[model samples]
Target: MGVQGLASFLDKHQNIYREVRFGRSRLLVDGCNLNYLLYFSSGLDQNHGGEYAAYVTLVESFIAALRSCDITPYVVLDGGSDVTDKKLETAAKRREDRIRKAHEAAASGRTMCILPRMAELVFIQTLARLQVPVAQCFAEADQEIAALASEWRCPVLSNDSDFFVFDLPGGFLPISHFHWREVRQSGSRSSVSCRRYYTSSFCSFFGLRRQLLPAFAALAGNDYVKLRGIDWTRFVQAGTGTEACGRLEGLLCWLKGLQESRGPLEVLEEALGLLGDLSGDKRELLQNLRLGMEEYQLGRSALSRFFLHGAPPEFPALEQEAGLVPGWMLLPVTQARLSGNVLDVLRLLRMNLGFGIETQELPSANQTSRPLRQVMYGLLLGKDRSSPVVEFDRAGLGPISVPVEPTFTRTSQRLRLDSLPQVALSDRLNVLLEALGVTQESLRLLPPQLQLPAAVSCYWLQTAQPPPDLQRALLLGMSNTPRSTAAFQNKSGIQKVDVDVSHAFSQWQACLKDAAQLNQLLGLPLPEPDVSRLYQGTLVHQLVHRMRSGGKLKTVLRSDRPSEELYRSLLSVVRRIRTRRTRQTRQKAATRRQQNPPEPSADLQRLFLQDEETESEARAAVAMQEELRLQEELLQVRTRYRTKERSNRSKNPDLARKEECRGRDLL
Candidate 1:
């Protein structure tokens, strides 16, 4: 998503980045990047689910390290993808690549660098616990991060190459070089050692105007605009980091040649001229080129007021800004209280990337949670809307867009998206409970945090393909069940990620995430679980293995009475919900059969001639199975929707294939 080969090119020049003993100032951190760096850098489990507690400890240590050096950190996170569809092509390619890598990682036993589902939630919660100032922006936080850093006269800490192009007064510090864990003390002062890059140094090295960075970035091909068919390698000077850095070096050299004589606008025009004849597409290309460059233009940070006054940043204006997002949701969306999937639903585009350890052959784990997301979609877009949400989900080794109609229950139909906040708490709770098919009374016996998870598990059991066995349900309940802090202090040794087990847990987590979002949208009718307490990869997988080896729950829990009680209480609630659902399904089936009875066939007459009680029991069982199958089909989104090709149809498939080949050759 940055200028191609820029990070490596800069890394080769030691003079461009000066070593600094960093401390005693405000540092703006890219929170999403930090989350990825922290989790993957620590080599925690990525296969099963996540080792969130250990990840929390790592975050706490990081914050403590910053405080020790008197360094103040203000973290910002990205909310959702850009609604303009500017980066849709890049996103689709990345999604396809991720799904392929995930399958490979699942088959082979390598770490795939996939951050678990709840890692973000755990990170945000940990920051709150440590009293670190943090904000999640409505969209990409790159510009906001750069803006805040410039205003504060402090370095932006991140590994993103886009930061290299942003004109920051303070500087840019790549997280790869920032040694927060290695704080050094020299008598009176404590400081962390790191490398810092000032835009001044970069501009000086390249002999170009600092303002030309945006133009330079666009010409080199970023996520926003990839100028096809123009090869700049022929224009580069021989042996000036050209072979190693690819086309970026060539582009920089060309920019340097025109720096003195031409302005940014002229350079853009001349660069577009290199593409030769575009016929009718020239204007569109020029507009896209300008749009790409506009990304690096900076202004006063909108987040300044957010950090200073506890106010959410105002929604930034978009190209398509009419009713794309409801005004009421802007605040919660900015606060990071609501999930980004909300925006995805509203925009009719759901970008779902596959997990690293999921079994590709199995039905996507996301399918199990379709019902939950459907309710959420209904709440966002009115109940009566017929438009389907186009979901870019991983299928086979590629990404496919499935058009899924949002399920609007009688409960969901009662409330409208705009007036949801004005609704009574009881009515909201009823909507949430009915959607999950549970009662408040049923959830009362479990811990507050476990209630939503328990309900999700019940829903999963009822709808999951090849319905989960009792043991699987019990393990899921245990995973959601909270344990003592001491129990999580030591991590179990790394073990191979079983694709089936990993996929199962992935589905459970998906359901929990959607349910949590639904609750948040419904004014938090149910208590939101502490994400860290919900699941731990190593512990849960180990427990499953122990149970499979004929170990009892008490033995696996080390005879911890309170933990066992919590596990049993959660399991009981889930079982009760499942039982009630089955009863309702059977009753509905009986009513339907009575309303439209089939003529008695020979087989039915033969069955009726046998024992009356046995025939009735067999007939009831068959009807229940048929009814359940039909109900599951109704709940599952994929079954109801038709899949479409990748949305970026403008790019020829053959040309894209050639580009992939060319990319490898350039590398």
Candidate 2:
């Protein structure tokens, strides 16, 4: 369904397409494509316990691999199909297949909806939790991928081969056979492995350029096109003798010439001359191709949003901005309680996003019994679609606020059903006690297994006192709500026959089986499966395990094992970190040498800084030499005075006695 025969062409000439891979390249990912691979890898689950958790785990692992290799990933998922698309019939066929599967699952007592949308939701939520940029395309993902790749100037990573036809300048990378590509230096330095591929190399080998790819793609039918009898192999066989490949290259050049002027009628004349003699039905064939080209053009127009950065109506420039209240708002029974209600249900709800809702206050009802419920309905009704809007990380909803953004807003400007944005989702859950009007502690008083199941049991019980077992079955996701009734009771007095409990025991058994399968799928044992982790784990099993009642159960006691893939990923990350550290150290040393020219050795360094012991040795030698010089001078002076003093002493003994007396006085 991708470019027809493109895979075979690439396989036939694989060796000529060679390029070096970079660790830090930007990659655009096809989220749905990767999720299907993971889903298949995880054998079919018999039960649906923690389905969201399983999806979150697989996606996180794949993302980790991309990140460990230093790739900046931009994830994109397919949104609801375009109503005006040329391929609605194909999309409908797929939906019918899902409907059939849903029926079959219902018949088999499987409560979980195994549709692809659930997986898509899980993907979007996981990326949101990680604060990663993700976009959901309004229609087919192929054109959007091409458009965004062009805008972002990064390689597209997808299993689909439609990218070759899309004619991206950067080309696409298929990760279906993803592995390390070893690149050796021109000299005998060394080789290193990285994940990379270049599709342009393949185009060049086939004697095609970026501009000519879409023409070549048209030759082989694509999703939006249905041209016939223009296969590459057919062109290869059209030439005479051993020069057929050269003739094929000539054909490409002719096609490129036709496209230079960009006029359909003018190109049609040249196409007729080139293709006229190829077949007896040339006119009909060319006409069919012309129609296909028109459709492709129309498809591109429909998907321009991907290339167009959203420019909403201009908002008023603000003089100042509001700051986030990072601390929790402790809503005691006073503020959280409704007009007449005494129990505080709002306190149990965590206003996540590390920010509060930011909107104006809804007019409060003075006399209403359920003022909070009235406020919620008013907020939902007051949402404006075309209002000037600004995206904020955290906005307090101290006033009237609709959900900050709609779920499908990434790709879609419209929806069949208004999607509620602020709700619980996979891996990052807003665990709210919705409609459970009771003390948080009182709700916790139930047995551990009974707590979550009790919420569902209470819903059906209050409506019609249906047995707790049916609610338990419904809550476990082991049985579907009968087609006769709504998913759960609503404003209308919706009623249902008692849920068939013939398979209640079997359903419980299936829950255990699904939990076991998740472990097998995860291929490790960390703790007995906790369903809530599917939502609240934040993708860390260790953290989720600690949240368990038993407090950090020994992993060894559960299962002492490691996965090879896990270790390999860890090892790759370790190598990357080591390489980074080495590069930094080398750069630092180079800078140091540039500044100082030479690094001093230990002894030289000591001399340069004047160590105390070395300084003391030099000081001691100088002191002793000075002392010797002074002693020598004193001895010489005494020798000169000695004879004169002796002569004087003989001349005057009495004077000597007086001098002796003066010396005694001086002493």
Candidate 3:
């Protein structure tokens, strides 16, 4: 329970201790060996002696001390055990196979190892399982741990002297006091001294880190046998000796077996997750490690498959030909790559127009004698049906003939204003102009009609017209007719034509009759008016027509005496025309109905006959007595005759008469 040292360390490094508490310590541990020890110690029952129990207690105490000091600890355990001896043997064989693979990799001049080394795997697995809040490495655990300690400026925790080769930034601290005592007793005073001795001894004995460790090991010797002072030099030189080959084979087999072991898989996944979560330098290292592992496991052939085909050479070359600097050239290339052919053509036009052209090195110096002609040909051609040519003055260039080619003779011309073709250019020209900072007045100064050839002009002509207050009024009546019926309207009241003159003139017919009438009334001897007068007259007529038809005639006629008279005349004419139109419409409707009359039902016809008789009697009685008496007598005689006729007709009198006639003819 001695905890003074632990408490002191925590107090001294409060920030470091806080980080550890929050799981931020980048501590490395030996997983496989720790697990083995834990299991071994746990198995110690009273029967197998109390020694294991004591060991476990001591280990637990040490862990508690570490926790109290805020030193997060990770533990590693070996896979081999007494009960799994056969498995261990098989695993060892696999390890040797991996070592041989590593040797082969080294021979092939690759920096990769064949398998995650035993110690490295232990450290990685322990750190991963414990979820130690720090960067960790596995496979050649001691080496990686030392490397990590150097990277983090932290201490390395291990009894292995091999870690000294890494030159850890915070130095080394052995886990066991007994080991420290043993080293001290062996005349190594300080940890640095001990480390130096270990480094020199190992390098001398095993020739470690000589170009490539695995290859050298494969060629010269084995550590286990060499450390034991066994002479295997001749066997190594021959490259066919059993001992040297056996050791190398064993080492490779052991690595392969470790790779197959299930313990490393979870740790590898955790490492991969950490790698994914990392950024900057840490992430890069982890990535390199991951790649190395992949290379080790899958071999170089698999690694080769990950590379893509090299980019085409002509792309950069084309950019260079465009007289663009490296970075600037790429933008156009990118634009060209993504845009449709039409856009590309536009871009080329802009480039030619000296829009984005800056003086730079052309692809060839010999070609500099000729002026660079950059003109947007697309601007001369319509992008689509709706495109229009934008007119602007060309700037910064004198007439020069551009060489067509080595075969065709150069055509010398003033880059004639007439040379440009007329075509539909998009409004995008304005944007380009703005970018160029060119003013409209400057554009106007260009040669007369410096008309863009192949460019269709879409010009709009605006006319200045007086306001609505100056508009004249015509009169319209409820009968839908204009009162004055003037063949022409007066232009004197018209202030202006707000819209384009061309548009107003196009609708000139609507006001033409009004114009003729106005001319007749005014007695203004006029020939066929010009477009301006026509537009002006048209505007006046429209205003008058609108006022007359706008349903405010009383108010419109109230202002002026002359207007009232005119209004009345127009209204009278409008009403007469409307009345005639209405009558004609009604007559047509009535005639249509009579020609295609609907038949009356039987009941209606009977009612009509009864009513007709009653009416006829009433009318007879209302006449004078004598006239009435005469009418009544005549009616009575008519009725009697009508009855007799009906009877005769019904009894076949006609047939009888025909028979009598025939008999007379026979006689």
In order of appearance, the predictions have TM-scores of 0.86, 0.43, 0.20
Question: Per-residue CA lDDT of candidate 2, range 452-482, in tens?
Answer: 3333233223332112233322322211112
User: lDDT of all the models against the reference?
Assistant: 0.75, 0.39, 0.29
What does candidate 1's lDDT look like per residue over 54-136, in tens digits? 78989999999999999999999987778788988898888877787777777786777877877888998788667788888
What order do you get sorting by lDDT, best first?
Answer: 1, 2, 3
Highest TM-score model number? 1
- Listing every candidate in turn, what is its Cα RMSD in Å to the true structure after a full C-alpha superposition? 12.3, 33.9, 45.7
C-alpha root-mean-square deviation, candidate 1: 12.3
Per-residue CA lDDT of model 3 for 1-667, tens digit only, reads 0111222222232222111111124345454334333434343221110122233344555454454445565432221112212123343444344434333332343323221111122223233223433221111234334444555555555545334333444544433321222211123222211221122333343333322222222222222212122232222424433333433333323333333233433333333453344446555543433432222121111101111221211222243234321232222222111112222222222111101110111111112111111112222232231122221111222212132211111211211112221211222333222222222332221211111100101010101121122212312211111222222223224322222221222222212222222221111112212111111223244444455456344543444444344333323322333333345665797697688774678447757788886775465345334343444443444455457656865798765464334212211
The reply for model 1, stretches above 4 Å from the true place, is 238-245, 317-320, 347-356, 384-386, 470-495, 598-667
As for lDDT, the candidate ahead, 2 or 3, is 2
